[model samples]
Every structure is written in C-alpha cells, then in structure tokens.
Target: MTLKKPDPSTLDLSDVDWQVSTFESGGGGNCIRFGRKGEWILISDSHNPDGPPLVFTKKELEAAILGAKDGQFDHLAGLG
Candidate 1:
C-alpha cells in the first residue's frame, strides 16, 4: 500500500516531541534537530529551536538517512 505524505502545514509542531541526535550533544557545534509527527519528519536547526522547519515524509527521511550513511551527501558539508 502506498502511504500518503502528511502535510506538515497541518501539524501542530508545538505538540511534537523534538529531539537532537546524540552526536549533537556537547559536540561544540550546531546541528540539525528532528521531530516526528505521525508519518512526517520535521527538521530544524538546533541553534534555532524556534525557527521554521522542513518537513518530509517518513520514506523520504529514511532515504536521506541511508544516503548519509553511504556518504552520498558528504559534498554538502563543503558548501558551507
């Protein structure tokens, strides 16, 4: 069965439980924070907890995680 992507716009982000990766703690650097609401995954900068976030479907988030594990997005780090 195909899963429908949930609309982040319809979500109440305030009610979601946001979490930071364990690697982010005491790393002396800012990193991304993520939260999940149903099938949607929301991402935001840890430094800006109140800032706007980018939302993605669970499948899309999974794909991104896999890509990161494989170093497929290593080049992005240099773009900063």
Candidate 2:
C-alpha cells in the first residue's frame, strides 16, 4: 500500500540541518530523515500525532547507519 503524505507540521525540525532521504527502513516502514555533517534522525510512524519524536543524536544515528552500511547492523537493519 502506498502511504499518503503526512501533514507538514509534524516533522520535528527543531535541530535538523539537512535532508538525509525519504526511504523505507528494516521493517519496511517509511520515514523521512535529515542528516547533518555527522548525524541523522529517521522519523518513523510519523502519521501518529503524539509523544516525542524519536531523537537520535549525530554520533548515534551515524553509528546505526554506518553499521547497516558495513553489514554490522545486519540483524539490526530491519529494526530502525
């Protein structure tokens, strides 16, 4: 199924600095992410309008993404 675009206001741009990419994650979930020189945040289940946006600081997000790229996150790939 195709996901309808979510409302614009829901994106947490509080500290976002650049576009990472709008793509599907491990669980086949769709998310829009932003990346800084050394960081990124993958926004998931964004259609919901509650709770804090999942926050991943630069180093942490970088590790996760890098791990996936280098096959270190093979098991975790389908996770976030």
Candidate 3:
C-alpha cells in the first residue's frame, strides 16, 4: 500500500506531540525532536520548536532510523 505524502504547509504543528530522545538527557540543548501526525513523521530541532519541521513517510523514517543504527550517517557527526 502506498501512503500519500502530507502537505507540510497544511499541517498544524501545535497538535503534534513532540518528544525528545531519552538518550539526549543533559545534551545541552543539542538534539532533535520527533513527532507524528496522521501518516506523517515530523522531525524538528529541539532548540527551535517553533521552526518548521521536516516531514517524512513511515517507511522513509524507518529507513533513516535503520541507517542511523548502522552508523551510515556517522560521518556527518564526525564519528566515522
């Protein structure tokens, strides 16, 4: 089944239940927040909650999470 992408401009972010990762405790304001609304997964900077969030489909978010777990993006963080 194919999921339709949501229009970010039409999304009301106020309704999203944003959450920070537990592993980010005491990270000194450096972290990302994630939330979900309908069929979209939302990601935004924790330091700027009022800023626009990046939206993704379930599968897309899953792939990103898997990649992170595999350290595919470690280079971007200077870890690889």
Pick by lDDT: which candidate is best? Answer: 3
1-80, model 1: which lDDT tens digit per residue?
86765555666787888887777455665788889877678998888877778888778889999998888888887632
Error of 3 at 54 (Å): 0.6
Question: In candidate 1, where is summed lDDT lowest over 10 consecutive residues?
Answer: 2-11
TM accuracy, model 3: 0.82
- Root-mean-square deviation of Cα positions for candidate 1 versus the true structure, in angstroms: 3.5
The candidate 2 region of ten consecutive residues with least summed lDDT is 35-44
Q: Per-candidate RMSD vs. true structure?
A: 3.5, 11.3, 2.1
What is the per-residue lDDT of model 3 for residues 1-80, given as tens digits with 9 covering 90 to 100? 77677767788887889988878546686689899998889998898887888889888999999999999999997899
Query: Comparing candidate 1 with candidate 3, which one achieves the higher TM-score?
Result: 3
Q: What lDDT is reached at residue 13 by model 2?
A: 55
lDDT of 2 by residue, 16-42 (tens): 554434554444444454433223344
Error of 1 at 42 (Å): 0.4
Give the runs in model 3 whose Cα sits over 4 Å from its true position: 1-4
The candidate that wins on TM-score is 3
Can you give the TM-score per candidate against the true fold? 0.71, 0.40, 0.82
